[model samples]
Target: MRRVLKITLVSVAGAALALNTAACGGKKSSSGDSGGGDGKKSIKVGLAFDIGGRGDQSFNDSAAAGLDKVKKDLNVTTEEISAKPDEPDADKESRLRLLAGKGYKAIIGVGFAYTNAVVKVAKDFPDTKFLVVDADQCTVSGSNVEGACFSEEQGSYLVGAAAALKSKTGTIGFIGGVNTPLIQKFEAGYVAGAKAAKPGIKVLPAKYLTQPPNFDGFKNPALGNEAAKGQLDAGADVIYHAAGGAGIGVIKTVGGAGKWAIGVDSDQYNQPAVSSVKDHILTSMVKRVDTSVFDFVKAVADGSFQAGVKKYDLSNDGVSYATTGGFVDDVKAKLDQYKADIVSGKIKVPTKPGA
Candidate 1:
């Protein structure tokens, strides 16, 4: 049985991290030192982001929300660095090294792409505690590294059911940022849930914007738009996208066509970039990267930092289906029941497509 944890979303003013635009390399950003004169040292945290950092209004933004909470409640000083599209692993290693060398005691690599880099850098700075989101920490040899992993498939399942229930054309579509094993989890749960909700529903073949070693799929809005158009043209009236920043294009295209679009990572219904198409968003598979990030930082600050994989799933409220725009209001009861069933282990969501 999975351990259940309750998480509350905290909203605080001035929670946004201030980026130093003048920083030349790596687009590095830092928050002002919040150490007070009361003889207590403020905890310094380093956050390394994946592609489409911060304002992508999706994955990175979800991580940013956690950092923002840390700043507001923990009074922690922080630094942020983002990855470039298709950048080499060396760059990621350098970014980790730079943060560790700067004496940032708690460093977080915002995506699984930093798995190798985090492991490599953890060996060099054993005193610094490191957490990588989406990667299993148990596989690491370093004693100071931990991982924040989420059961994204669980949340995706709920939204998939929603898409199937609301889809008028009885044909739904899925778009992945990259054809990685991680993204495949979303595809798996979605297809399974859609079929479970409405047997014999027509699901379009999953489309991937890019493949490995080329992560441009996560950041390319044009590619997302193009993929969405293809699905829509093929008679898919409901589309779910786990395409990170590129998901904006999916929302735009799908909504423009007056079809339903399901968002991933963050709630797209409230995102300003997709405000014009907010009504078209049926729901979002809300993966609480923010909660995991905040929990990791809080653990480090409170000296409770443990080096191991910490998994978040539906049972813990770490991932959920968003009901923004009230578009799914009519089906909320059914969605909640499915969520309960998943939590009780009555239904097991698949981590791989067609499994």
Candidate 2:
């Protein structure tokens, strides 16, 4: 038998109230107490989502799936909170504090933006374990903190190859949510993979929706739409976006134009928000955030938690390309061969653009 967990969607204001309620003893959990009849300890887990949160149908949703799996497979109680667009670091700190103060034994922060906040808060709540996705624990060390990161470039490479193989115009495009090193990795791999598949491929200059400190790029569909239109008008027949929620606009615009659009993080073809344009989705560069999150929580529950970074890559099935619409079926063999070359060290994907 399993317990059902109710996850609430609360605004930043509502989160403050939830924090206040927790301070007044709303819910409580003891450290590693075996409560369930099955001898498994029932723990309280808190998830701090990235911008666009659970319904973005992309990155945050992938993390939410892991939390959902934790709820189904383990004896645990859960709470989730999301970040606002362009929110300050203080807000992230506060969210982590809120979860720690609520007595959550394990807290997971869903994006790289939480790096500083996770480092700061984990210090105050040494008893509570913290995991920040897309962050490197080695760089931001904390005794109680761990990181879940992925080789996004490796996955992006596969989709870029797919786009190159399918493109009839010999031109493709890459759109990033923010102009950051992380997003650049996606561009680098896409370009490298496209060029690898076809030596004469023409890739347009990368476009970014926003720069640092204005992360709204991740949640702004309008920006994505504008960028996609520009690329399409410039003769790009296939477009790939690493733009989180904003990718919805990319899909819509590309689909409306009957061109191919590749997705990131989650399989957009099956994403309900983009169901109407599923046919236009070429494939997605699937990064397994869900597996990493579940593994982190499970480690804490089993008292095997380690404070360090864990990297998920092609060899571990942590990153790969999706084939949801069967759009890439004809090119699957070539893509797999590329994947094998990458895994076998015969090919090394670039992590920076123009590298």
Top TM-score hit: 1
Candidate 2: 10-residue stretch with minimal lDDT: 12-21
Candidate 2: tens digits of C-alpha lDDT, residues 196-261: 999899999999999988897899999999999999999999999999999999999998999999
TM-score for candidate 2, residues paired by index = 0.90
Candidate 1 Cα lDDT to native:
0.85
User: Can you give the lDDT of residue 300 in candidate 1?
Assistant: 84
Tens-digit per-residue lDDT, 1-355, candidate 1: 2211111122345345434342334333345445566555577788888887778999999998888878777767677777776777777887788878878999998888888889888998988999899984225547898888889899999999999999989999999999999999999999988999999899999999999888988999999999999999999999999999999999999999999999999988989999999999999999999998999888888889898788889989989999878999998998899999999999999998989
Work out the TM-score per prediction. 0.92, 0.90
RMSD value for candidate 1: 6.3
Off by over 4 Å in 1: 1-40, 136-139
lDDT of 2 at 233: 100
Candidate 1 residue-wise lDDT at 344: 93
User: What range of 10 consecutive residues in model 1 has the weakest lDDT sum?
Assistant: 1-10
